[model samples]
Target chain A: MPFVTFLDYAGVAVFAATGALAASRKELDIIGFLFLASVTGIGGGTFRDLILGIPVFWVINRDYVWICASVAVLVFLTAHRFESRYKLLLWLDAVGISAFSVMGAAKGLVVTGSVSVAIITGMLTATFGGILRDLLAGEPSVLLRPEIYVTATLIGAAVYTGADIAGLAPLLASILGFVAAFIVRGGALRFGWTFPAYKGRPGRHPDDIP
Target chain B: MPFVTFLDYAGVAVFAATGALAASRKELDIIGFLFLASVTGIGGGTFRDLILGIPVFWVINRDYVWICASVAVLVFLTAHRFESRYKLLLWLDAVGISAFSVMGAAKGLVVTGSVSVAIITGMLTATFGGILRDLLAGEPSVLLRPEIYVTATLIGAAVYTGADIAGLAPLLASILGFVAAFIVRGGALRFGWTFPAYKGRPGRHPDDIP
Candidate 1:
């Protein structure tokens, strides 16, 4: 299998595990774990495919679904074995997002031939799954955080698309994209790097209003 | 335009208005209103198209986007005019969902040629937009409610698809579907109809668990 394809599957597996863990927090049934896992792992890519007017990746290929189900079941059974599981999960999730972002941009570039749209596709592909997961779990979404999460995806997409446009090999451009996203996300995870929240009068906290 | 086409646009308009109202509650800016409105109007249909491996509706026809944006701007400017706006909004949303469910199933049949898949497409098309709206607005999702929201959509979809399969005329079948969904939702709205929650011993409330 090609390297990019391998990274896609690996990213999906780790993301599925994260979804299963989140489902456990809500005391959802076994079916919920499977459902959440499948959605979370592929949600971003599904959105990307839809916007690009292509067949969703997992529809024609059931292997992705099997991988997600396997990861979810594994997480469900052995969740208690690992200490500091949530922390580890976050780092793994960062890796998954990076992989997804690069792949998403590459796909977008191929489909649309527009770097700006491709960059947005990368950001959406990186973040939308976790957004869907939090929504399903009824938790506050990471999008609400004043973090550099989406920005990292943007940087990765832009770098990759720029390099590709500069006539670099697809493999090298993809590696650069993945490395850029991983570095930014790692900084955020390890050093708590975040963007400043909007503090203007119109952007007042909802609680402060009522 | 065909009657079904008109219902689709009407549904999109009303749903977009509801999304704008939701955004206003969070004090989101005008741009937020537009974003939420667009998502709320077409979110379900987009999912349906994606799953059926068809091109998304809005991307091909910019008219849908224009309608959603127009509704959002109208709602954002006049949200405070009514004293019981949310109550009115719920009734309007019910109408939109009913219309969307019928049309979605009809389109699904055209694309997938399976009544069962079409029924599911109807349900997703009716409820998913509101679900997306609530998630983006950081509010408690309607899916968590015991009320007959999704059930109403399911009823409409099943009724319509069944009628269509029974050789009913397309327009009549669609009308039956819309009426069925609207009645259930309207009844729930007026009488506070809801389902009983499962009160399992081991699966107690999350707050009560710890």
Candidate 2:
């Protein structure tokens, strides 16, 4: 595989593992784990493609699906042994998120020719899948949290776009974007940094249950 | 309100109610119910628009959001009494489904000018919300069920396309499509008719699940 393909596969594995872990937290069965993993691995790219009016990438290329499945299976088999090792999981997720964020921005810029849209797409591509996983798992989505999830991705997207405009090679731009996102996310985690919550009100709840 | 707006509001209400019922079955809290109801109300249309490369309709149109919220709250309050007395929820759902199916097709056709694509969009718009609700509710998605769900929508889409091609008025074509879908779906439900399931075929999982 070429460098891009190799890195993309690695990112897929990490993201799929994150999905498997989320399913395990919810005590879902193996099938649920696989489904979650596949969605997390491909969700960002699908959103990008859908917005770009391109055919969804995974639907056209089966390799991504195959990798997701394999990773889910591997994670399921070895998950118990790694149950206590949460730091490693978080780091893996950070790496995958950073890489995917840059990749998403690059794809968006190439397809749409709009830097602002590319930035938004990059952030969405990085966080949307995890958000879905969290929502389905009945947790507060990262988007709703005070954490610097999308902010880190936005910074990375800006950096990547700027680098590309300055005539940097795509490979170099991607590597720098990935590093930028990873560092910001890691710093946020280390320092317990967060965005502002509405001073006191998280907003009133709607009356009546679903 | 225009006739189209009336139908659209009614459709939103019905879908929101359906979403509430699904969320109730899953025992979601009030906020979660709101979330599901909102998604169920707008989810399918959003998917269709996204695929067609448009800004999401709800984000652009505020009325859709308010109508769905109102309907969800009303249904949450009145479900037990209303469900027991009239037994009309099923009828209302069928009507809503048919109308939305036609509208979905019309919108897609107007945007893409492709009959096949319009039919697919119609089916998606009619059914995708239900799928989202089912998935989040941890129930099997309707798409995976051996059912004639898409078939009913397909008939409506074809009728609408044919009527439009023959120079029929848009309103008349829409009504014809809606009625065609309503009949097919109503018949299927009344007779407990469903599609044939694949026993030994593609997309089959291994026999490890219970």
Instruction: Please provide TM-scores, in order, for all candidate models, with all chains considered together.
Output: 0.61, 0.56
Question: What CAPRI-style quality would you assign to candidate 2?
Answer: incorrect
Q: TM-score of candidate 1's chain B against its reference?
A: 0.93
On residues B1-210, what C-alpha lDDT tens digit does candidate 2 reach at each position?
544455566777777777776666666676766787798889888887876666788899988888777766776676666543222544555666787788788887887777766775676677677768777777655433333555677788788878887898888888898889889878866785664321122211112212
Task: List the lowest-lDDT window of 10 residues for candidate 1 chain B.
Answer: B23-32
Fnat of candidate 2: 0.03
lDDT over C-alpha atoms for residue A208 of model 2: 39
Q: Candidate 2: deviation at residue B105, Å?
A: 19
Cα deviation of A73, candidate 2, in Å: 1.1
lDDT of 1 by residue, B55-137 (tens): 77765666887898898888777776655555656777899899989988998988888988988999989989988887787
Candidate 1 residue runs with Cα over 4 Å from true position: A1-43, A50-123, A126-139, A142-210, B194-203, B206-210
- Interface RMSD value for candidate 2, one decimal? 12.0
lDDT of each: 0.80, 0.71
Strongest candidate by TM-score: 1
Best by lDDT, which number? 1
